[model samples]
Target: MANALCDTRHISYAGCVAQTFLFVFLMSAEYSVLTIMSYDRYVAICKPLHYGTLMDSRACATMAAAAWASGVLNALLHTANTFSLPFCQGNAVDQFFCEIPQILKLSCSNSYLREVGLIFCSVLVLFGCFVFIVVSYVQIFRAVLKMPSEQGRHKAFSTCLPHLAVVSLFVTTGFFANLRPPSISSPSLDLVVSFLYSVVPPTFNPIIYSMRNQELRDAVRKMMSWPHFSRHKLLFCLYI
Candidate 1:
C-alpha cells in the first residue's frame, strides 16, 4: 500500500492479483484460527479433564496447518475465478484493496457468475464454522452455569468473552461486505465495511486477549519492567 501511494496509485497487474489473493487468504486463515481458539477455550473450560490431551501441541499445530491450507485453496479458487472475468468496466477499483466484491464491479460481462459460485461455497463454509462456534459456546455456558463457585464461573466468562466479541465483529463485517446487494453498494459503505472486515479484527484480537487475560497482562508488565530492573541492578553493582 505504501508503494502504491508512493507511485501515485500505480498498482501493477500482478500487484493487484497478489493483493486480492492475500486478502482472502489471510482473512480466511485468521477467522479459522479464531474459530479454533474458541474450540480450545471450550475444551479448556467445559472439558477440563481432557483439555490437555485434546489440545496437545501436535493437535494445535495440525489445526493451524489445516487453517492455512484451507485459506490458500479458497483464495486460489476466488482469485482464478475473479481474474477470468473481462474488466470491460475498466481497471479502476473504488476501494483501497483488491477484494472480490469491489473487483467484480468492473467486470465487462456476466462471467462473474463463476466467482459468485465460489462466494456461495465460501459463505457456506464460514457459516458452518460459525454454527460450530455457537454450539461450542452454548455447551461452555451451560458448564459455566453449573460450576459450584461464582469465581470459577466468572473466570470462565472472562476468558470466553473476548473470543466471542472478536468472532461477532469478524463474521458480521464479512457478511455485509461480501453479501451486500449491488444496488446498495455505495463507495462509502464499501469502504467502511471493508475496513471492518479487513483491518479491525486483526488489530483488535490481540488487544482484546491481552487486556482481558491475567496471564498476558502479567507477562507484559514483567517484560516492560525488565529494562528498568536491569538499569537498577547495574547502578547497584557500581555502588557495590
Candidate 2:
C-alpha cells in the first residue's frame, strides 16, 4: 500500500480504510463462526440433556449479535484514527492493508494515543479472548470425555476437534504477525501475512463443519429424496 500509493500505483487514504474494513469483516466472520461452534460445543458437552432447549433459534441469534457487536466496535476504533486527522503531509502506508501501526507511522500528527489503543485492543481481543475460549473448551472436553458410551465419545471428539484446530492456527499466525519484529514488519511480510489471515477463515471453516457433520449430510439427502418418494406413492395410489 505504501509503495503503491507513494509511486502512484494506488491511492493511500482509501487503501488504508479498505484494509481496516477488510479486517473488520474477517474478524466478524471469524467471531460468528467460532461463537456458533462454541455454542454447539456447549450443548454437546455442558448441557447434553437440554441442548435443544438451551441452544434454540433465539440463543443462536444472541450469540451472533455479540460477535457482530465486537466487530463493529473494532472497526470503529481502528477507523477513528484514519479520518480523525489531516494526513496531507505524508500519506504513505507501508503495508498491504491499512493497519493502525503502519498507518500511524505516516501521520504528520502524534501517534502515541493511537498506538496504545492498538496495543490494548490487540491483546484484549486476540490473545486475551482466545486464551479464555481455549480454557473454556478444555473444561468442556474434560466433561465430555467422562461420558461412558463409545458413541458419545466419538460424537464429542468430532464436535470439538475442528474448533480446536481453527483456533490454534488462527492465534499462532495472527500473533506472530503482530509481535512487531522489525524484519517481519516490512510491507512484503505484512502483505504475505495479511493474505494468510484473510484466506484462512473461508477456506477452513466449511471443510471443518462439513467433514465433522455426517448426520446433516444424511438429512439433506433424505429431504431431497422425499419428493421423489411422494410422487411414486401418488402414482401407485392412482393405479390401485
Candidate 3:
C-alpha cells in the first residue's frame, strides 16, 4: 500500500526481513491449522461417537499450540537462512512480496544450498500433511457413503465439502506457486500465481464457510432483497 501510494518499489532491509518472517509464519500456521481441521472433519464424520472425547477442548488447544510453534520454528529457520546469504543479484525481488524463492534468486553464495535443502525438507513435511488430508477425506467419504439416511449424508457433505474446497484451493495454488518449473516461469505468471496462493484463499475462505451456514445465507439473501442494498454492498460486507 505504501509502495503504491508513494509510487516507489523500495523496501527497507529490516522491513523486508520482517515481511518475510511474518509471511512465512502466518502461511505455515494457516496450513497447519487447515491440516488439523481435516482431522477435525475426519473425527466428526468417521467417528461420531468418539468426536467429543477425541476433539475435546484441551486436545484442540494443544494442536493449535503445536501448529503455531511449528510455524514459528519454520519462519525462524527460513528467515535466518535466507537473509544470511550474500546478495549480488541486486535487491529487486521479482515478486510483489519478499518471498523466499525470490530472495533465493538474489544470493551470491553457495550457502543458499543449505536453505534449499531446508526447503526440500519442508516440502516433504507439507506433502505428508497433504497426504494425511487426502486419506482423512477418503475415510470420511467412505463413511458418508455408508450412511443409511440421505439427510445424514447431505449434512455430512455440507460440513465437509467447504473445508475440502478451501484445502484444495490452498494446497493446489501453493504447490504450484512454490514448485512450478523454472522453464515456464515469467514475471507475469509468477505474480499471478503468487496472488492466487497468497491472496485468493484467505479472501474466499470466510465467504465459503459462511455460504454453508444456513442462518448466514438466509440473512444475506434477505439483505439482498432490500431496496437500499446492492450486490456490491453485500460483497463489500462479505469481504469485510
Candidate 4:
C-alpha cells in the first residue's frame, strides 16, 4: 500500500528481497513451532510422569530457539537462490506480497532451478515434521484409550483435538496453495487458498485454544475482567 499511497508503483530491490525473506522465514517458524507444540503435547499426555523433566522451561526455550534458527536458515537459503535469478519478466509482482512462487513466475531465466531445489528441501523437512506429529498423536491416542476414567480421557482428547484440527487446517491449506499444479493455477484460487492457510489459522488459533482449553479460557476471562475489577477496587477504596 505504500506504493499506492505514494503514487509510486515501485519498491527498492532490497525491500522486495527483504519482504520475500520475511515471508519464508515467518511461515517456516510458525510451522516449526507448531510441530514442537505437538511434541510438547505428546510429552504432556503420553508421558505425564516425565513431562516436567522432558519439557522443562530450558528445554522449551531451546526448542523455540531452534525453530526460529531453522526458519532463518531456510529463509536465507531460499532468498539467496530466488533473488540470484534474473527477473526478465519485469518488476510487477502479481501477488500482494513478495511470495516466492509468484516472484519465480517472473523469472525468464533457468536460475529458478536452485530455488526449486530449496523448495524441495523445505517440503521434505515439512513432511518429516508432519510424520512426527502424526506418530505423536497416534501414541497420545493409545495412551488416552488406556486411561481408567472417562472424564480423564475426555480432558486429554479435548486438549489434543484442537491442536490436531489447527494443524490439519494449516497443513492441508498450505499444501494446496503451494503445491497446486501450474497448469491449473488461478489468481482467485491462489488468493483464497493463501488467505485460508496464511491468514485464517493465525487469526483463529487463539479462539480455538481458548475455546478448548479451560485454563486459557479462565486466563482470557480474567484479562477481560481486569478493567472492571480495577474500577470496582478504586470505588471501594474511595468508599472506605
**Top candidate, metric lDDT:** 3
Sorting all predicted structures by TM-score, with the top scorer first, yields 3, 1, 4, 2
Assess every candidate by TM-score. Answer: 0.85, 0.73, 0.93, 0.84
Clashing pairs in 1: none
Global lDDT of each candidate: 0.88, 0.70, 0.94, 0.88
In candidate 4 the C-alpha lDDT for residue 168 amounts to 88
- lDDT (Cα, 0-100) at 184 in candidate 2: 47
As a whole number from 0 to 100, the lDDT of residue 60 in candidate 3 is 100
Give the poorly placed runs of model 4, Cα more than 4 Å off.
1-10, 213-240
Q: Residue 27, candidate 4: how far off, in angstroms?
A: 0.8
Tens-digit lDDT track for model 1 on 98-147?
77877898997888888888799888999999999999999999999999
The alpha-carbon lDDT assigned to residue 112 of candidate 3 equals 96
Off by over 4 Å in 1: 3-7, 180-183, 213-240
Q: Quote the lDDT for 232 in model 3.
A: 75
Model 2's alpha-carbon lDDT is 0.70
Q: Is candidate 2 or candidate 4 better by TM-score?
A: 4
